[model samples]
Target: MNLWTVQTLVPLPVLVPLFAAGLALALHRHERAQRFISVAALSVAVAAAAGLVVAAHDGPVVNDLGGWAAPVGVNLVADPLAALMLLISSIMLLCVLLYSMAQGIADGDGRTVPAARGAEELRRTLQAQDADADESGRRDVLPVAIFHPTFLILAAGVADAFLAGDLFNLYVGFEILLAASYVLLTLGGTSERIRAGSVYVVVALLSSIVFLLAVGLVYAATGTVNMAQLAERLPDIDPGVRLGIQTMLLLAFGIKAAIFPLSAWLPDSYPTAPAPVTAVFAGLLTKVGVYAILRTQTMLFPHDEKLEAVLLVLALATMLVGILGAVAQDDVKRLLSFTLVSHIGYMIFGVALATEASTAAAIFYVVHHITVQTALFLVVGLIERRAGTTSLERLGGLATMAPGLAVLFFVPAMNLAGIPPLSGFLGKVGLLEAGVVDGSVLAWILVVGSVVTSLLTLYAVIRAWNKAFWQPCPDERSLPARAPIPLGMIGPTAALVAVGVSLTVLAGPLWKYAERAAVMVMDGSTYVEAVFPDGAPRGTGESNEVQDETEGSTP
Candidate 1:
């Protein structure tokens, strides 16, 4: 219970953001104050997560809430997997916040406008003003104030989900982020955004209900929602019921992760949001679902060949279907969104293989994808800003006109396509190698599917690059050169692009850490022992027995 211990750091990622969100909301009228609050909070979170990553190298760091122990009171656990995710996500969140702030998003009410119209004009107008409208649009400024607080809340929600020790807490975490996403997605009240937000809301709500039902079933069956306890109790439940619960959970998370067949909503939903919002969503949200699947599959139900086989099939379909969607897209944002869906399959593939090596590869891939995907979306945002449109046909000669932007787009694009020595390639290589080790007929099939997906992904992104930067503008009059791209905006995008590269530079250590984390994940005892060093109480509801420690209070 020391103030500076790793246990104490477990909840900071969640608490700091929630506390800052309240402060940010209070100071919303002062955009500078809001920005400072958000930046400082996320910075602190990033630092805390880094500490946890090192501390958790020893084992999972558990913080029991109100000094209550596990199987009763809720706790936050930062194991290697959770800490790794927290660190990467916090970094991404901080970078995107800086990018949005630089883009002058805080000064403007969210609204769509033609690129030829200066950003200054769009920033000052929320809706069409009446003839008697005053020169200073005070109403417009108030709407822009919502961004900081909501974004912080979203950050906290993601952290909470990552560190959540119990199924109910995980569900709560998903709802927190999803609710904030609803607002962010529909910020401008544009018809398209509103329509897309509606669909998103419905789908998210449906998934939440399914997840809740799964949690309820879990509690009923095992009499405990804490994951550490569930890991011990789940195998003891009826196989049929366990299978049903597992399927329901997968179905819920699959929808969120945008695994194909359940992914139709994503391309439609994400492209409608503002660039920063879309970038963050593309980077973090779906991976959260994938993280959940990884956690539950490895921890709660290890060595389930049936589920693994089904997952492999879904993984192949997701990769092929998603890339095909991307190949057909004309708009840069939509194409990136589809690629986002497609790359998720790689992570799923790593998970379904369910070996220590494959799990490690999945972890590495998630880190790589989160950084690379967010960078790509942010680049697309820049493309939209410069050209006034993201339509591939309308964009051209950007390699000459904005050589910096072209380089910015190309690095992450190739990295995403799994080019050599890049983090993306390293991550993919890890996965493909793991699949080969497995040597099953299905694994071999997925190996082939994965390579095909990578090639097609490269083609999809290169096609986008060729059309947007290489080809001549379809109509010369459509694009008017704009003012110099802001340094603030370029700084964060470049920083993220740099992080993606750094992942490659750091891949040796990263891969080793992922391998260690995977060993911890594949061996559930590492997590269960960390949460409850002594054997945990095994029981159903009030019928269960409890043991007391000298300082412990029973639930």
Candidate 2:
């Protein structure tokens, strides 16, 4: 019952950001205050999530909202998995915020204009966009005030999704994040961004509709939407009905996760956003979808061989197709977007295997990919600032001009390619080892596809590096005049790159923690008991530690 226990930390990740968003919005005229609030809020979230990661090692830490019990009241549950995700996501959010603030400073107050455009040109562009909007009956261009608040909302939504104790709450979290994302995706209100955001909004709406319909069907069929309750109830439902619900959930999450065939929207959508927005979206948004699938598959419907087989095949296709697309890309942002899609297949491969080792590998891969991919995107932003374009054909001699940028780009690039001893290599090795342990025909095929995908990913990034950094600039006059790179932007990006490498140095403990988290996920009883101990709803405002005390007192 102590106020300072880990349970107290559970909601801060969600609540702090939501509250900060309000403050940031209120103080939008004070850019300094807004930046401080955003950074401080996310910093607190990161610290709280770190605390949960340590405390949750013993078991789950639950906080029933308003003293209400599970299956009735909204609650937050921070097991090792959710805690780890929260920590990583908070870190990414914080780093990207710094990068964006720096970018805003360079672009005149909080505006996010292209570096190539002069002040007069940017003013004209905004005026033109506004004029076009008025004629078309569209919303006018948003001012700089909207960015921080919306970003905080995004952070809150991600936290809520990770800690959600029930399916409906998870759906709410998804909607919250998606709504913020649509705003962020269309930040500049440019015609290109509008086109990309339009496609993104349509696709996201479709996914939400399907997810909501599935939730309704699930409630109708099972009488409860709490994930712990569903875990117990799903096995008893008609197998056909269970499968139908399962397929629906997968379809919705698959589109969000950008699994092959469902992934066409990503490359086009992500590349059009501003760099910081793209970095966060690339790193965290799709991973949230992956987390949803992992949670439902392991807890609600474990060991369905048929479903696992299908996932494995899809994993293979996602890998091969994504990499092939990456190989064909000429733009740096689009290339990274494709590789992002391809690497997701590796995570899916691990999830399909569904063993402790495989699941653990999937968790590790998610963490590795989040840091490395985000760092890579941030570096690309730097490249664009330096060269005025992301076109591979036009970029060259960056290595000679900005050696620091070259290093920043190279470390993550090689890691993404799965070079030896890096976190990427370690994650891929873990997944491959799990596949070998599986030893089925489809598993072996996935193993081969993964290897080929890794190789192709290496080829794609290397080609990008050679062209962007090493090759000659075809038209030197087309390049922007070199301004000193802002330390604010470079600092956060370098910090992310270092964190990516740290994943390698700290692999031993991180991997073990992942294994423990995987065990908790695979064992539904652990989660169910944490939520409803002794087969009864918990008392109002009760924490998991209190439940343990009550259990001990029962004689």
Candidate 3:
């Protein structure tokens, strides 16, 4: 591509949604216009993401803002991994938009008659009362609405996070997304949602603070906040100082990723959001954490072998504990949220391995998990809508009533469980192969953990299927009548399922791209060069003094 075209490509993915969000806010009075703008923006973003991926096949695409060169101005670098993530985020956003549209249409239809009757009753009641207590007094009693322009703004924030070139910019992007999420999470202000969102907000804010501190320290130490420059300079930094900065960054991202010990907040917060919001969060947020961790480990501290054992142990623990949590949850959304935490361990396992093959596997797993996880959550949403509850006790005979939804749920559920001919299976196989190739005790532990987690995941999915679909509906006559599934809802659900199936069918090319992405990440020279054409000053590998001291003195 020409330079102008290359420059325009990176920004389009972010700008399209951002402009759409602005338009959506302006047109909020007209919900139809807002929906059209949101969908159109996401569609354009998806197309841009696909183009970026295709362009990245040849090499990385670096877009410098304001025509300034890297190391002087910010650069948006689109490597294969970044492109793949953008693609996954686009797909999930598209599905969420469709689902939300369906929900809005359904609510509008069902609420109109009741709303009119209620208004009439209120008018008559007011007419019999004092003239001073008029319609204005009751205007404040309007029902809370969920679907809004804020959701589109949230989408823009996520896109910005994926495409950001500098640490400070990433932080800004994260804050935007987090603020939007807080609103989305607590929408309608139900007691449970408020309680959950309060905890989520505190935890997320704490993590953001930690990240801010790391960014400040890194900039102070290295005189730059650009990730690519840091990668170039970090290796040459004082080992002690380097270790401390790296550890802080990792810790902050770990909290975000919900890695084992820090993961408690995710399960508590995620299931409380609206279905589309929950689906998007389950698919994108934690993975962003993983992306940060991947960047830190591979780019900034590649030679820090001291943390390898700790990462391995934590990965194992995370997997086991998360899967166990999944087993214990009776609610479909909560179960899936816990499972999301468990799967992050698998990604961390690959990062700890720090080999090209392992990283490739991690990349593959990330893509596969995003699609499967989001689709599963959407399916859970469908189940809740149809059955009027997501509790295992309340859901059943979906296979009989909604065969289409059953197929939609079953395919992704089985794939997530690592069934054959699916992308999940391919991902697990790739991870296992990487572990076996490494041939170390840690690798063996990871391999075993992968297998056990897969089995537990399988069990959890099967249990959900049995309780929610296979078994007879309890008190069938008493249960609510089955509602017709909206076309808007089915449209997105079908799109995501199709994407997952396509991933399975096209595993070869996709895996190759992932492998290439992994190789690119493992060898940081290309990325460094892309950011700093004339070669920036290198770090002295002694940046984090305290961490180095701890590592040096540790038994």
Candidate 4:
């Protein structure tokens, strides 16, 4: 219960990986040393995030840095939503690490010889060096060295974003993650990856700049950048000033979230990264933007009708347009990337509704989507590895050769399509039910859009399944003998699929926690109170009314 104890515990999730990142970088020359440091750091972070979730199950836990009170010094706040996000992000980091290990092994085995002849000599030279390094007892370490430190740093940044209590600190955390992502996205420096990474970096930097401008405006207007303080003072601000700040912040976050029109960069950039990196990015980055939206809507401008409507329209457009893009894609990664964009609509719909049930549904969907989407992407990666390419034209008959991979892809694909008895279906049901209870035309539109999008997603998944798994392998006579899949690669993919299945099995408890998280987020007063024990109070206003209606209608 000591306040100082909280600070020590609070920063561990962020610090562990950061420390590991430094160690990994220093030991970059020794691959084994770097991998050990990276994995150890992530293991500790996962444990810490789990502990934080347990501690915050009942309420928020606030830690003031350097023993200074809020408004004067930084604070780290852990609410249920933040804890849940941290836990999911940590799980994703673990998967990415495993996948990286697997890919490294494959690449090291001379399996990754570039399709072009020009690179074949480079590959042979590298393989020769690898053999020499192995003779020197350093062979295993060379394949996946950069992955450890880069991924550890990425995890640290995500944890920082989840724990951040101030607007400026959140911005800083985002930049940290963004910088790490730039490296990961362009890691091999392939032409496709470099082009994609360039777009991603430029778009992300622009969004950060806009976010900084908004932060500056908020500070200038309110005299403080602490989220708790901003929440308290937001209601008292001039309507015009509040609107301007809200618009600027939303635009920045919207781009990051890939909401509707601002989403063009995502599909183009995400598909070019390595599979594990793509999976982690699919799971974590956009959610950070959604998290920002959730924070802004509930805490900063709770009762803005115009803003809510705009969000509603954007959600609809995003759902429709993204799925259409998914359906049109021929490559597995590109298809999944568009699907990722489409699902952002579901989260936006929940936020636009701004009711407890809808918010709870949003939280549930976020968790479920992260697991399901990451699993599917990894499965696609596995498919690419087994079949020699991710394009539908090159990938076929996987179901016969790799039944395990097929099952892994199918479960999440079904769940993502919102099929019955899955977490995705349950989440969509919750959103639709919330829409009905709200009794608004916008809510009804969202409900309809949800159903349509679900069906379209099913079509996209079925298309991929038919072309990649069910159909006969094209040029079967010319196909090379299938290479052995590394146990390390399969392990992480299996773990992610297991997590998705577990989500379906434990939907009840998970949904309950999600509801609690939604309530906590909607009622920002508790968060503010946790952060600033002596700060001026903030009103819950319409949020309380929405919560009451939701509770009254709950079965």
Candidate 5:
């Protein structure tokens, strides 16, 4: 694609939602209009992202925003990796939007679906007893008006981060999402949400402050904030200064990615949000942080052994500590939350390896985890909506009472636990294989940690399932008669589950794409070339990036 075309398509994913968010805010009184607007905007974004993905297979396509070229103006790049992320993100957004719209319709009025007349009374009684809980998710619920607009903005921010080629714009992307997330995280104004939102906001602000400082430092050091220029200049700077820059930048990104020691905020904050809110946040937000880490690690400091070693240790700790927390949790949402932290370790493992194959494995796992995690959370939301609690002690007989919900939950739950013949299993296997290829002691330790983590994940998930689904309910009130999850909700949730399966079915070709993306990411020159076509900086001599590409050719 030509630069003009690329410019139009590359920005559309971020721009379309931004414009639609305005419209959504304007049309706040008209629920149908806002819903239709959201669906249409995201549909257009998905098409744009899909096109970009197809185009990027040839090489990256770059756009100079505002018609100004590098170091002076913003740049948007649709490299293979960015394009792939954007495509999956768009798809996930649409599905979740569908699910949210369905949920709003159902819970907007507090009437029970065709149940025994007494069941309605019981619901009302339960509503009276748990007034705060009802208010938290059902009464005074987050309006579609605000939810749609903020969600659109959040989606745009994610897209921008993936496409951004400048640090300032990247910072802007993070802020855009962070602002929206603050609102989304505290949607119901419940005490738990307020508490969690406060923690989230505080953590987010610190990260942003550090991020801003890092950007200023980079500009001060290199005379530019453009990533390509930084790539060029960083090599010429003193090793100490470069390392300092890398340290600040990674520390900032690490908190955002929720890497261990920096991850204390995630499990506490995420579980309190409403289901759709939590699902999207879980699926996309930290991954954005991981994406930043992946970009800066490979692009700015290519292969710093010390940093890699540090990340390896962090990865191991994250895996063990996160899953152990999951095992200790009684709440499914919180269990999943800790698992979210744990799984990030897998991606970091790929990153620490700093090889094309390992990077490819990480990328593939990222996609798989995004789908499976979101789907599982959506299922969790369904459980809450149907059974009225996510506490395993309160939830049971779901297998017999809500068989469809059981199936929906089972598929993704197993996928997430890395059960055989599922995408999650395949993704983990790829990561493990890459670790084996590395054959270093640290790599072997991580591989072992990963396996143990997966087995524990399965055990935790199964334990929850057996308690929530297979076992008989402790009381009749735990489940109402014939409570059906609406088709609107089921369809969207099922769509994501289908996507999880697709990863397994298309694992071969997608793995190749990830390998190609890994090659591009490792070879910083490809990125620099795309951003600055006139002339781009090459790493001093032939680096591992070049060697990896050379070896990538051998196979």
Candidate 6:
């Protein structure tokens, strides 16, 4: 009954997956063992995150590492916003892992005879594929040996990023996920993955460098990287310098989040990876960047109205440009990728408004998008599995061949398009409501852009639906003959779709939670109090009384 009493489970979500990653590495050769570790680790993570979400609904719970308070040592925070994201992410990660395990039956069958057709057939069946060619579709592909551990590491990174109470730790979390992601992106090291990996690595490293520099400047200006401490100091810093720091940070995060001006790299790199990898990336990675922007911008610089104007303009541009690109694409994955970029504008719109209603709606929208978008990508993966190609020009007639696949695709597709009675529609409505609630000139402009983008998104999804499932398969001889989807793949996709539907079903409770989270972001004193029992203790060089909440030191 007392959610606030559940304060100490914060770090377990981050730590368990890390420990599991190591265990998974030790058992990589045993695919069955790896599956057990992956599932168990993620299942525990989801439990931890869910408990935290229930607890965070009351307020934030700070778990100071070594029992040391902020501005001195690390702390894991489970604010409503962070906990909500973590819960959703953990659930998605678990489902995707199951999907990967089922789809990833790696290495050949249990027989070993050099050049034997059975072994060779098994190898080709599990061989990782390079999706570089536009028309060339899905294939049996990539290293299952390393998948479990690498994926678990990525999961840890995601948890770390959400739970981190300071900027440096957040950056570390981003790096953790990024490093693991490099392996996933290039799974099985196909030529296409190699080329795609190169571009991804270069862009990611460059963004990290910018983020590092921004952190340095923020420290130089404010003398602390703790978000709560920065909140108190940022108001006093020179406006020009603060603005500069904000721009640099946003540019870096924007690039990572694939916000319009800096979004070109995404469609190119994401579509080249294997479907599951692409699904997870599409689902989680960019959102981390959006989460960062949400955290830093709202928590650090909440009052700068001038900066708000700039963000509003960028939001409008991001929405319009991104959807327009989506409309122009002939490939389903690329179209989805572009739509992903466009929707970030909606979140940014809420961020720009800086009002409680707007922020809450934005937070709610993020959760909805994460679920729907991920489910859609998972369905796309299934499509490739059944049809062999993602190219709209090369795909069709699946409505009959795999009616189940069509239903799986249809729900998320409608949700993504903001069709009525779907989570997508509710999310867009919330954002629109936020914009209307704001009623400023720029907010109104963003409102128009948001609506148009949604309409365009529906068009794009319909186009994809028509080409991929409704229409007859083009060049039937080009693809390997029709095959039934694995229960593993279909089951996970269905689970996620159900999860997305649940968002609409539970929209009221979820929105209420988002409201609670937005309040925490707006008022930093509560967090400061929660983390450090004593008031503002930055640069004191003396240990303030850290809240004795967590179980112990993190390994």
- Please identify model 3 stretches exceeding 4 Å from their true place: 109-146, 477-482, 537-555
* Model number with the top TM-score: 1
Task: Summarize candidate 4's per-residue lDDT along 1-555 as a digit string, tens digits.
Answer: 454554456788888998889888778776567666777888888887887787888888888778787777888888999989989888888877867765665656422221211123335546665675655575654434466777888898888888889999999999998999998888655688799999999999999999999999988777788888888887777889999999999999999899999999999898877777888899889998998899888887886889999999999999999999999999888899999999999999999999999999999999999899999888877776676577787778889989988898999999999999999999999989998998889889888998999999999999999998998878965554344567778899889988988998999999999999989889998888788777653333455467788989999
The segments of candidate 5 whose C-alpha lies over 4 angstroms from its true place after superposition are: 1-3, 109-144, 478-484, 537-555
Give a tens-digit lDDT track for model 5, residues 1-555: 665676689999999999999998887757788889999999999999999998999788888888898867888999999999999999999999998888666644422121111224335534553564453454432233488889899999999999999898999999999999998888755578799999999999999999999998887776678888778888887799888989998898999999999999999999888788899999999999999999989988888999999999999999889999999999999999999999999999999999998999999999998999999999898887777678888788889878998999888989989998887888888889999999999999999999999999999999999999999777765444434467888899999999999999999999999999999988988888878888864343345367678989995
lDDT of each: 0.88, 0.90, 0.80, 0.83, 0.86, 0.81
- Model 3 per-residue lDDT tens digits across residues 1-555: 675686588878777877887877766446677777888988898888998998877667888878887667767788888888998888788877778777657655221111111223323433433343447663222222224556777877877787777888788878988898888777655677799999998998999999999898888788788878887676666788887888888888898889989999999898877787788889888898899889778877885778877888889999999999999999888899999999999999989989998899899999898998999888777776677677887788889988998999999999998999789999889889988998989889889989999999999999999999888888966555444556777888888988888999999999899999988888878887777778865543355555678879999
Candidate 3's error at 552, in angstroms? Answer: 38
TM-score of 6: 0.90
Clashing pairs in 4: none
lDDT of 5 at 13: 96
Off by over 4 Å in 4: 1-7, 109-144, 477-482, 537-555
Q: After superposition, how far is residue 446 of candidate 4 from its true place, in Å?
A: 1.3
Specify the poorest-scoring 10-residue window by lDDT in model 5. 110-119
Better of 4 and 6 by lDDT: 4
- Each candidate's TM vs. the true structure? 0.94, 0.92, 0.90, 0.91, 0.90, 0.90
Candidate 3 global lDDT: 0.80
Q: Give the TM-score comparing model 5 with the true structure, all chains together.
A: 0.90
Candidate 2 per-residue lDDT over residues 452-534, each given as its tens digit: 99999999999999999889766777665544568888999999999999999999999999999999999978888888886
lDDT of 1 at 78: 91
**Candidate 2: deviation at residue 196, Å?**
0.5
What lDDT tens digits, residue by residue, belong to model 1 across residues 1-555?
Answer: 343587889999999999999998887667778888989999999999999999988788999998999977999999899999999999999999988887774334322121212343343343343222457744334444678888999999999999999999999999999899998988767688899999999999999999999999999988989999998888888999999999999999999999978999999999988888999999999999999999999999898999999999999999999999999999888899999999999999999999999999999999999999999988887887777678887889898889999999999999999999899999998899999999999999999999999999999999999988999766766664444566877899999999999999999999999998999989988888888989876765544543334226744
